[model samples]
Target: MPQQPNCFHAFQQDVSAIKLPARFTFPFYYQPHPLAEIAAEQLQQTLLTNNNWQHNFGLNADDDPDSAVGKMFGILVVQDQQGQLGYLSAFSGKVADTNALPGFVPPVFDMLSKDSFFKDDLAIITKVSNEYKQALQQPLYSQLQRQVSEQNQAFDKALAQFKGDASERKAQRKQQRAQAKQTLSEQDYLAFEQQLSQASVIDKLKLRDLKVLWQQRIQATQQSLDSVEAEIQSLAKTRRKLSNRLQKRLFSQYRFLNNLGERKDLNDIFAETPFKVPPAGAGECAAPKLLQYAFEQALAPICMAEFWWGRSPKSEIRRHKHYYPSCYSKCQPILGHMLEGLALDENPLLINPGKDKHLAIVYEDNDMVVVNKPSGLLSVPGKNIDDSVYSRIKRQYPQATGPLIVHRLDMSTSGLMVLALTSRANKALQRQFVERSVNKNYIAEVTGIVEADEGEITLPLTLDIDDRPRQKVCFDTGKPAHTIYKVMQRTATTTRLSMYPKTGRTHQLRVHCAHPQGLNMAIVGDEHYGTKADRLRLHAEYLQIKHPITQKVLSFKVAAEF
Candidate 1:
């Protein structure tokens, strides 16, 4: 604290959030002009008034407006130095009053605007463009559906063929057994063998002993057949999972590409995949997660097909699995196969309320948590019975409290997820994210050959029924999900990329990457977002945050390849 108590009363400012809450606390994260030089008139005077910077603005580092956005010019905020009290903070006017006190700047009010100022431009595409895009979309979506249909047909055909073949083979085996039993009747066998052995000096051992050996061999053969059947059942289960995943991926890829062709703007949505054949060294978990991540990421671009009953939070969640038993009313035969493949989870399934339920968390802290969930994974269990990554993680680590989520990640996009463990920590971390205090980065491989080495993408996203679960890149309906993507590496087969999702959104990265005006390409391997690949190539590369317990800035990075 300054020993001199020669300052006036509290001075302040008012600020507001733009379309998507641009930044919360302005002065804190603002960087200033390099202190290497200052204006001649304000040089010495600036030195003298250096200590008073914190008095006007809430931050204390040497900063200016030249190098960055919130430099020297902003509404001034004032408060008692010793008091640990202050408002949530607001923005002041841009104009400053020079003739006023040394710390006097502009009068301020309201941290956030009472309303948003965006005027959405939801102009439908031209007939020509619309028709062109539809031509591409219909084929792909239709193909995906066909793949599933054909798959079912093939399975049915194979099953029928197998059953017929099994019946024929079983009949043959039954005939052979019967013939062998008849030919080896005890009376005929004993008499014939005795006559033939009369000439041999040493007849074989006793017939009773031989009969016992034959019975043992028959039992062993039956056991062998049982083991073979069990093995076939296990293999069948594995094949079904693989087939289902593949079909899902193919559909996701087509959906992303079809959406891309419909655009007429900045970048084209790409349709190339970015995965190399599975390397020899991929471990079990690594392979599955990678494949899962790719599918999830691709799915991220696709808007959830089912909404309204999609995302539901805890304060508004409920129990599931209702039951209404009636007296003497039962369908015993039908109930026999009811519980076929319902896997048991620790928690009962919960239903979602809106599109927000499946938002993924990409980053987390003591008070907040991030998730990179699936289109199906709820952000938080809708009802007590619903199972989401949020609920699952918290349950896994009971000691950590306050699983408050600050921002949302697309459920399908494989990216950074964050969370806070406590309310205080949540507030602090939220400020950091809101102020653009954290540094985040990602990697996305689109379908096309992007010529740009580095570029910024600015597109607005809005909710559209046509974009079911997918955010349409309309000027008016959506908030800005800015992304700066660079072509990291390219192959004749695929293109690799690095990206940074500037703002968190329901499906920002996928939609942005696939914007027609931009890349005009789908993120390869992103079945939900763009082109479905073996997996979603999008991965959260880095995250920076102020540690809740340490009170120091901390960073976390995940490799794109991993």
Candidate 2:
């Protein structure tokens, strides 16, 4: 394998004391190894000082909004052929509208290069679109189109008038026949009826002639219109064919390599997934580019991590300098092949964190009961696991008739949960939830200090179609979610908050705190939106509701373990 110039970066600080990771990174999850963290910090410094290129990341006050965007940067720790330790850096997608930047790994395939076929095909498509637009502006074509519209309108008016006049004449003839029948002989009456029939025959011939005249006029105009449209249609057809061919060619060129020197294109990687076709930017993420370069140069891959930089995007919740997991939609299938045969870090999600935990019962009655749920326990049974709050309660009370659980908490969230013992109690408690009559409060510790004491967040949320179970802020096709928060305690490094959610959307509280438009801080231990920790640092603390049988307000409180 050949080496690229000036891409591999050796560590600046002394890392002799740090222990290297035993296995490579699991791209979709896992905390950053210490060596990877050091490499990331060095790259971030380069981003601040390097001036060879210009891109508006919206970090400055005067940056242009149209061009500004945040980027995901990744670092891959590797060992060169001589056993020299260093790392490779890469940015997701393109940087400064190009892929060839100093101190970064090159793209798997550069579509923007001067000699690439993509540029030539794109130019051809653009020319066809321009010609199509110009053809529509031709004077002859415009005139012919107006003539078609006017001719149709004229024919409708003439036909309507003719029918109306014929109706009037028939009514007058009927009255005259009745009068003649009363005053004249039968023979005279028959002659009068014959005269009325002749008039009707003449009107029918006139109506037929009118239709023929309009048809001829319309046909003459349409012929001219069709001649002009033929060229436009031809251009449109060519554009579609060219665009499809260009896209297919581009996907084929984006070939990725694994540790064993195996290769697969974008189309081949995504063929077995639910989305039959590879999404728009499938092979261009930071993780794939870094790993591809490492393999190409025979650099032994050790560990990797990706982080967000600059201003956050409008939809996804991204904070500056926050470590994030690889996206599931685009990179999961590709990495699944790229990481083949590498003894990677074990996926933490597959292991049950609640296997030895116990359910603590707080209060009990014939109608309802309150219990303190432990963190790392599922509120309901999941696809792979059957042990949850519902399953545990069912085992304890075999005589319980209705569904044991009324509401829910996220599997990572620990708090107080109320259960119903009877069908009537379940119905009554469920109604209160639907009507937003139940009052609840949550306590959480975030990663940063919050300046404001209290505030409200009104952001709409929807699921990322490609990434399941993860919600993003979407104004277009999302449900309304509202949350109110007050700061309870603040330290130099963290802020403890009490949050009240008005709506019960999935991940409402976590997203609200993490999103830039909301609190701009993630819950300290939230693995989904924040960095991983000992626990999620979020707990359901207080809940108040009306009793089903007693009709009296019942309030319950549980202190957080953290």
Candidate 3:
């Protein structure tokens, strides 16, 4: 391959005049770039004008035209050799004709290409998988399974026969004792019963021998079955090993170039993480593809953005024409290594934008204090954040001891929080929370109008470990979370609600609100589950609890400002 021209010179000339972004976006949480916004608007307009645009983009028409679930799109702003600014567009999976559209960039690797190594390796993988499947359906395999089943049944039948014989012998022994008792004195009858019991022991021992023999026969058949199963498992392992090897080789071939004139393959990019190498198609996401091409072509990266272009999937929450941050599981590791050597922007997410905001004290006492926590403030100190409600309380009361935080609210959710001033208060408040004595009401504005006036949502929730901080609805291994909600008012496209949570789990309300099985509508401005807004439209409205010290029932209310 010929060396590509360096497009960085034109970008460098304008670098001095450009005010770089405070940070490279975390890729998991961000607002779209200005250029991307323009591009998205243009794309939306194009779709409106062209009735056959879906066909052109190679998108399948949704079964329900009223549904908003569709596809994800991405755009990267770049500077050409002439210093002209233009954007590169891409889709999440694939667009029409394998991403061969004119304004859109192609994938890093063409796995769909007939001439590629992926095709050849996939053929071998398919052959092995088919062979394994065929082996399981062979006549010998079927015959062995049937033999095992028949042997098990035979053993069970024999065991039942032995048991029946033992019962009959016991009955005969009892009848002999009764007959002897009718004719003999009381002492003589007792002696006769003892002798009968001794005779019955001999019969029991014979039955035991029969049971052992039957058990041995069953064990022999089971061993045969085990051997067959082991053989089948070995074949499966072989197929899996071949497929894994092919994937590793494919990832190794996806090499990315950085502005430092250094090149590292996807295998090297993820070498340090838990995943030693990038997953399949790790570098094919829109952001990585555009950046890689820019570095190779020497085009300067100005800004980049990714958005969902169509309806959301049934399994996850997404909105039409809404911007979304890049995925962390696939893109983070790749972007972390790819953004090296350029005069890149600082990651704005790393900075605490709400540090200067003070915690508003709603109620205070010697034993405990209630504070109105602002949105964007952490309830407790995080790994990178030290300015939190707990930390602030500690600063206010230097003499206080024990865990101060009795509960927590989401960083994006503004609400009333009560902090304990002493260990006794902490224990008391914690007990109330555990016993479901504390009553809390949250006010929120959801994206869609709610049809019902009041209802309760019971959904099991568990963390999506792969995607940190994001929770998913999982019935099998999840904790139960409950929320009762009443519609306060309905707008044209939104519903304002008052929610009372019965159980607290991470992102409980957010997940419950957006879950298809629950309300099926996301809270407005829920960046993780819904669309981005100026802020999350959720606020703590009211709290009711017993005073830890006085044992007096106290209630506090803070109306939502949204």
Candidate 4:
């Protein structure tokens, strides 16, 4: 086993046949280069056979709560100062309760080191947190709280009882005055009225006195409770302040060097973005770790890739041995600065994928039109590109009125789409979609063979706030997404499925198919959740809706190209 300087592992096999990538990888989105793939394979072999460390990735038993989590690992192919090719490996965040590993690159900043100021400040914060907890459990505090609660309850009961008795006495006096008016002289009636008035005044005075007495008693008890609670609150405030200060200091310590040797801390990187303060784990991803180390050693970066290494987490979809792009929230801004001087690959997202493809109108009527949308075409105009189904339809139907698109398929999805040519049709079609009266059937080829013939997926979904446009299964703050799928055909390695989405959520079918709780198979060529290929193997093959003007049922179907 040969190793280069500063945790760079030289390739054990001959890579003379492998061609180097012409440009460095665009970290936010890319397909792994050949060299990067080979490096990853070598690293994976090490993870399987080596005994240098131990950490349970929850691969064997997923139900065990004590198991450690799986992590993302990255590989960066580089040329050393002597022009020798090798790769540097790194894991996101920490591994096995530490940031250092023998074969992998070190973190840009290690806050866990014994001499680091983060450890000392964290200790103080922990101490304050303990003190706050202890204060909550104090017997005196508990006693005072109980006293306040009891005093308030007793005052309410007494006040209600006194008011009830006074009302009864007043009713009795009114009845006596009414009877005396018929049986006594005017003089006697007048004296009786005076007596009744005097009795009512006395009752009012007593009620006021009672309220004042209870208010004083409750105030004394509440003052004791407040005093005890103040200590607990002070400790809590101190702990929060200490943690924030420590976090800020730690962020400042993570100084990243670009290819040009320019340095910027995490704060400076995220200062202009929507998240002015850097997120909790901003510079802790595998890509940044790999890039930082490469620049530090003055190595020329060739290409890079990152992959997941174990069991999928509960909230997000992650597959073992699956390659993924760097996250947008944490790595995008940081890598934008780090890879500045390097000649990088062109961003695929910026190019109009549907430019050369033709949009064929399969059916057209007075009120509606159906078209066969090709793969890699957007359902509507995107932020950067104007060539889409909606845009092309506008050119075709210049006199069309109101919102034309009834519903949408993913940009990567190819097949049938219905567009309304009149305002009345648009409203009716949209209402049907909202009512779930319109039926849509999609055909997709997934990576693995599914055992079940047909079933319903009921996973709730919400946006992964950190990663834009990516949806995750979140039970806490998610909308219910339901999908019914049936196995159409099966091969040794892949399965064809007919997906009927009960609810039209953004990426509903894709997420359901890829999630562990759903089909547990990623759709073929699904770049967001699965591996990338020439195109996503998902198409809206069938659509059923009633005509708005005629009230007649209409159906449309288009065969998939693949």
Find the candidate with the highest lDDT and give its number.
4
lDDT of 2 at 525: 88
Between candidates 1 and 2, name the one with more favorable lDDT: 2
Candidates by TM-score, descending order:
4, 3, 2, 1
lDDT of 1 by residue, 271-308 (tens): 12122122111111111111122232221110001001
Task: Write model 2 residue lDDT over 78-113, tens digit each, in one string.
Answer: 988776788899999987888779889999999989
lDDT of each: 0.42, 0.89, 0.78, 0.91
lDDT of 3 by residue, 111-149 (tens): 777778988888988988888888798787788788778
- In candidate 4, position 33 carries an lDDT of 91
Candidate 1 has an lDDT of 0.42
Instruction: Give the count of colliding residue pairs in each prediction.
Output: 90, 0, 11, 0
Q: What digit string (tens of lDDT, one per residue) describes model 4 on residues 1-562?
A: 2346768888989998898888999887888898999999999999988788877777665546456588999999999877799999999988888899898988889888888998888888888999999999989998998888998899999999999999999999999899999998999999989999999999999999999999999999888888888888999888889888988899999999998889999989889898698988889899999999888878899999999998888878888898988999898999999999999999888999999999999889889999999998999999899999999999989999988999888899999999999999999988999999998899999999899999999999999877778899999999999999999999999999999999999999999999988888889999888988889999999999999789899899988877
Q: Where does candidate 1 have its weakest 10-residue lDDT segment?
A: 301-310
Off by over 4 Å in 4: 1-4, 58-68, 139-213, 357-373, 389-408, 415-438, 542-562
Error of 1 at 60 (Å): 61
Top candidate when judged by TM-score against the true structure:
4
> Which residue runs of candidate 3 sit more than 4 Å off their true CA positions?
1-26, 45-69, 97-100, 134-204, 360-369, 394-404, 419-437, 447-451, 456-467, 472-481, 490-494, 512-522, 546-554
